[model samples]
Target: MDGDNPRTPLLSIVQESYLPKTVSIALKCILVGLNIASIAIGVIFMNECPGQYLIPYYLIISGVACLLFLCMTCLPCVDEEQVTSVTLANLCAQGVLLLFLFAFFIAGNVWIYSLYHGPWNDPSSPEYCARVLYLYAFWIITLCHLCFLVLLCTYLCLLLGLYILKRSIFGSRSS
Candidate 1:
């Protein structure tokens, strides 16, 4: 392939193949719904525990970012060159952000679980229902974060593999 008119990057090819028109639309819709549900649950948990702002805040931000990503995916993939840079950059940025969010969600879940599952693990406690609800909400948020993290990792790995392949192929030719 000519250097100037290079083939579409492997990452873009994988994304396009995996997320075709029907699949992309469906995935986008599902992601939006999940994000909205997770945000609403996070808000409810936040109301119960005003002092714990970390999880809910991150949850809100992740939801917004996911929506933005969905919108980006919807754009027509007209020019391969135009889409490559923006899509790769967006993927990398989102992957990094998701890593941090994943860590926060894991920590938050553990902390919340410890707080509610200790000596105060009594059903008779007046706030027991609220505690359970909060825990459940945190669990849901953690699961959502986990899903996104998995997707991010998959894309990153594909991108890395493609990069290495391209390097070896071009390097051998140059030699």
Candidate 2:
């Protein structure tokens, strides 16, 4: 009603989280733990193998990137008004980083899978890679793929449910 201040959607924005705070915090903690474990595994792998392969390096770099992404997400959006440019920028940056990391992880998958049958624990063999290291790397990437598929399916289901609900509500009015 006031001419001086127009009521806008951006101005009325509230800092509401998409996930409950407890759930979000718990998920972040789990991701942080996994990333740290991956980094440690990579270091152990490098020390034990000391080969020219880039698998260990890939593990380490991905772990670090995930950690960095987590930190960026944790940053508080100072400006709550105007769709929060700071938050938007942070999200966009995170998205780009995620795409790059996904591609990087896929490359790692190829590298690891191609060498699946290579020599393990054979010091004398030129292709020697510790059994433990190879197995761990193999399983970790497998787990990542499994998790991605589960999440993708869940998201699609959620979208489908919303679409059905919208159709039922609006379709009744038009009939």
Candidate 3:
């Protein structure tokens, strides 16, 4: 009777998602939509100012990278409990891509923000980038950085709290 359900352990392990599967799928879909929007904005940015191309390229690269990241993570064979060669390769690929993207984002920031002080409405001027594209890209980059900071802080706090709890529980037991 105990051997009747071979998938019991697999099902239990797979069901341990922090968010429900439906919610996870929904979030992924939403992210995909956002990525598409970003790419479209990037195209507009390119069309607006051909000289300052870094931000537009940055937007397109980051958006496509995110889309690929989402697709890679959603593969059916990506079981956390069962670490296969494919999973290892996927993880390594993701890490390399993220590192490259992070560096690219920093470069984009330098290029975009350095020119943040100039012509808002003149295509005749050399420094003129479309106001809408520049502002949107600026806010998006700023918000991404802000979000990363928030998540990092939250993770650190959680880790510290868990460490303190473990120490207290163990100290009380020893006493």
Q: Considering every candidate listed, which one attains the maximal TM-score?
A: 3
TM-score of 3: 0.75
Candidate 3 regions off by >4 Å?
1-16, 77-86, 120-124
Arrange candidates by TM-score, highest first: which order?
Answer: 3, 2, 1
- What residue pairs are clashing in model 3? none
The TM-score measured for candidate 2 stands at 0.75
Quantify all predictions' global Cα lDDT against the true fold. Answer: 0.62, 0.77, 0.77
RMSD of 3: 5.6
TM-score of each: 0.53, 0.75, 0.75
Q: Estimate the overall C-alpha local distance difference test score of candidate 2.
A: 0.77
lDDT of 2 by residue, 1-175 (tens): 3332244434324334778878999999998998898898888878565333777887788899999998987776354463442355666788899998989998998778877676645787666667777777788899998999999999999999999999999999999
When summed lDDT is taken over every stretch of 10 residues in candidate 2, the lowest stretch is: 3-12
Better of 2 and 3 by TM-score: 3
Residue 17 alpha-carbon offset, candidate 3, angstroms? 3.7
In model 2, residue pairs whose N, Cα or C atoms come closer than 3 Å (at least 3 residues apart or on different chains), thus clashing, are: none
How does candidate 3 score on lDDT? 0.77
Candidate 3 lDDT by residue in tens digits, 1-175:
4543464555445434688778998999988987888898988768675447677877888899989988877765356697433344666787888898788888988877876776644788787778777887788888888989999999999999999999999989998
